[model samples]
Target: MSVYNQPRRRVIQMIMIGMILLIVARLFVLQVVEKKYAKLADANAVSRKVVYPSRGIIFDRKGKSILGNDAMYDLVVIPANAKNIDTAYLCQILNIDKEEYKKRMLTAILKNGRVRQSVFAPLLPPEVFGRLQESMYLFQPGFELVQRQIRSYPYAAAASILGYIGEISPQLLDNEAYKAYQMGDYLGLTGLEKTYENVLMGQRGIQYLVKDNLNRPQGPYENGEFDSAAVAGKNLRLSLDIELQVLGENLMKNKIGSIVAIDPTTGGILAMVSSPTFDPNLLTGSYRSANFSRLYQDTTKPLFNRALQARYPPGSTFKPMIALVALDEGVITPSYGYPCGGAYYGCSRPIRCTHSGGGHAANLRLALANSCNSYFSHVYRLSVDAQKFGGIKIGGMQKWADYMHAFGFGHRIGVDVPGENGGLIPDSAFYNRRYKGSWNSCTSVFLGIGQGEVLLTPLQMANAMCIVANKGYYYIPHFVRSIDNDDTDLLAKYKEKHVVAHISDSAYQTVINGMTDVIERGTGRKAAIEGVRVGGKTGTAENKAIINGVLTAQKDHSMFVAFAPADNPKIAIAVVVENAGFGATYAAPIASLMMEKYLKDSIPAKRNPVVKFLLEANTIPPAMQQKSKLDSLNRKAAATLKNGAGGRTFR
Candidate 1:
């Protein structure tokens, strides 16, 4: 009986000892290892504050900060600390009643649980901030003014490309990636801001301060040993030419279209204008929400970045790519010729040519220069229906689609900006899905002429021009030229060279020579610049839209793609004007003016008339805007381009 009692006593003793150890370990963790509860404990006699660093500045090629930061104030409140203060005067300064103040206090309590701080009044206007600063101490520890840096665009241009920032949403706060961010924190919403958020958002700092019984900050806790300094966001240098951007925006004023210009040598975007752009300042500071609501509801869609999103047909601009594919596949030679009285009879429906009598389709370069529809249609049939590819279904069509992919189609080209759309490039599988596996190349023959089943963003067209300009290789189009005070992998991918499949240099020359002729003596003659060789292609993309439950044939979208100083190509540009009559009429001239500006640094004074007429032209369909919807800010900018010569011919 004694032995059994001893064993039970030992077991009870061991259990008691184990429970005591567990309790001790938890106490140790709460006291030292984990700082969460320690901070809570510190809250009684200490104030922990967050210090936000200034956001990175965005500079153009000239080192001018087009997208910069301007200091603003936020009124922060800790619900538990708010006591025995002038609630009425505070409300009066904020222009809110007692009920509204109570409502805000309740909201702050719910957000931060009565202990932590939350934003009460954010992005205060200059006058309100001045009034509040005069008597802020009267509010005691419950409220404080915090200085924050908000974005400012001095040029007030590139709204779509620079993008906007807004307070973090509850959805974003719940995300694991954003767990560290508070509810009132702002984050990039679109464009380059969204794309480079990680680098642009610097590290936040924490400071611990001793507080008096009245909740006033007495001094640094433990002599400031625990405080962390804030780190400023890394700055970025862009390839964008803001002056060029402004000019493009001015020319694209009162229109529905896009202009994408790139440095063909480096694949750096020189200027990108999504017409109907609003002032970037509209999306900043205290008025951001109200201004955004207005812009979002506008009929012209001033917020949309058309340069990287609009999916318009490449039109005759695609003829050169077709010629490249044909030349690469051994289906056609540089000297290949066809006899076309007026139309191509090979397909079920006749495809008409601009040049009817005969010699238009006489050779590859000649056909390209003339933009003969019959010639490219015949070449498309020959490549897809050729025996070497085992006919269209077996291999040919997919190969053609492969070439299209190599040219940066059918997928995002990964430009440094966000919201880029990979426009449609109908492959065999696509045809198989749409036509259920029973269709011929002629069924999509218009694709050969850049009219059917092939849609591309202006950026894609511009990038394709870079590929042509570089002969076979291209760098991904990007806005950032360099990152300042940083050694990171931020720009690594943009630095890589993307090479298309090996194609003969001679084949590229043939296509390039024809494009040069296009500016010299063909459809794109208007695109030529004095003493500078130019290569250009004009396009008229047929379009249709649904209106009141009816599919109506809208006016063709005028388009043009070009490369300047043709031999040693410096710039490549693509301009698209929606609902504009002919490519040569609107798009060609727009591209021409832009190219001239980029190459000569200014449009020759002689071409002032054409620039003036285009600047004042309103090409947006009447249905899109019954009256001009151009914002007053942009209208003022556009007015700068109005001081030129009189009206001139479109071509």
Candidate 2:
């Protein structure tokens, strides 16, 4: 019995040992065989570290810096994980009110679902972070100071073109594309910043770091081998010439207008100067919101991108486009003649020509050279008449309007710049809406001479000149020349041509001859550049306003469009001076000065004896001096024409 009892006791002991062994094996699997799973569980108790990538740089075509980034520190608090934080002390140190602190805390909880830690608000100016550092002991263990990139536009004054950056809103983060971005990430808000965000924003990277129970980072878990470094965003090389841009800004001082200059051959924008421009740098950093709101509320609207947005009547500048359309459509041959005789069709209004007193009968070539309204009126009427045979009339007013559309008038130029307005080109549909289908071509006759319901942006006007320069095709206008840091493949795509309008080579030469004559002996003589064979047209559109229940014409909008080295044009420009009367008097001279500056590195000196005489002729009152000189010039021109003498030659 003793021996049996001993064996049973041994077996019981063996069973106990087997149970212990099984427990040990289970512990080994949970701790050693699956240590990664256990480590993940521990990680849930610690904090996370996120590294943000730096934004890209924006450079001028010459590689000069326009916009770049600077390092900043953001005070990030994890509301859910923040424990026993001294709220009063934290608010005081961060220079925030208690209400603001509570609001941010609640927003973080709601945005991050209270399940994980998230940043409550961004720390701006970096000084806020310095204050937070001093009060770190009062903050929650999970709180952190994360480094961020703040956008900086160094040039400042190029705000309209460079644009500004702002914090991303809640809606933007909901999109799948922006899911990777955390709250408080800065985004390009306007201008080129918003236009090329995709190329300018670089790839994000990740780093795995170990953290303690207090949520403090303990460097990299695997000696930094597992971390991925962020790639800086690619830089953009814009086609804008900074020197010329500054020059243009200076020239536009105390004025209200826009100047747009482009290289006809490449469609490269050289200078896009809008008067009353604001500093882009003012809209950067901590004071961005306050300054932006102030600028936006200003009456002048300095933020308005006038170069691509403002639309106005092409005025007399429309004459050249009308001539080209008439010549191309064969509404009238170049030799078709008409008598200005002060008016056309014997209308009671007498549609007076710009010619002094009353003008003489003129052929098409001479009419275009003199900008004869009667000649253009005859051609416009003939094109609109269905009874006129052998006149290339397919659709009457509609067809003529289509030809203008083909010239890029009354349309957007599809420039790479954002917020481009498609200036109104009143068509049959537009008239139908306004007149309820009762308006006829005669009802909108003012459109024939480039006024009334016909509007165009400076960009479009310049592009029209480019179309003439190209003799048919036009490359889509763009600001970015290339991505500075990108491979050649990305830039190759921009080199492709985007043709807006196409005309026959023969028609182009004919139109070129007309423009050339305009500078040689017409209203655009003021815009002529010596030795360069420049061609251009001038316009002065009446500005009418309602006064005491009557439409009263007051100031005029001056305008000019020109191309240089007429035979092989390199530059095309459009100048519009609001409320400045007579295109030849104001806009033409400005355009000429700009052209001379661009082509010859200086404005052509005032060599004309008449110009010199006018400058020195101070006997007349200041108010009447300009009018007196203009009247004198008109008399001189009329005397020369009456005597059958050649027009004054520009030396």
Each model's lDDT: 0.85, 0.70
- Each prediction's TM-score against the native? 0.90, 0.81
Q: Please name the candidate that would achieve the greatest TM-score relative to the true structure.
A: 1
Off by over 4 Å in 1: 1-45, 109-113, 210-223, 627-630, 633-651
Query: How close to the true structure is residue 227 of candidate 1, measured as C-alpha lDDT?
Result: 88
lDDT digits (tens) for residues 1-651 of candidate 1: 688699899999999999999999999999989876786576678767788888888999888888777778889988898899999899999999999999999988877679877889988877889998888778968898887878867787888988988888778988998887887777888988888787788988888878776556778887777789889888889999999999998898888899999998888999999988887776777767766777787889888889988898899999999999999989889999999888889978777765669887789888888899888888998888888989999998988889999999989999988888999998888999999987997898988889878889999999999999899989999999998888888788888999997888888999999999888888899888889999989998899889899989988899999998899999999999999878998889888888888888888789989988998898877766865444653444334324320001000
Candidate 2 per-residue lDDT over residues 1-651, each given as its tens digit: 688699899999999999999999999998999665476566653334566778888778778987677776667766666877787887777678989988888888887666555665453444566777665645656477777776654344466888877778789988998786667677777888888877777777766677665445666755555467888787888888776776666555445567888888888887788865665555655555666676666555667888889988887677767766666666677667776666665344567665543344355557667777766666666666645433222356677678778777767767766899988887666777788877555666677677788888988888889888888767777788888556656445456665535446766776678788889987789887778898788887777779899999878877888899898887888887766678887678767767777878764456445334323322222343333222332243335334432112100
RMSD of each: 5.6, 13.0
Residue 432 C-alpha lDDT in model 2: 72
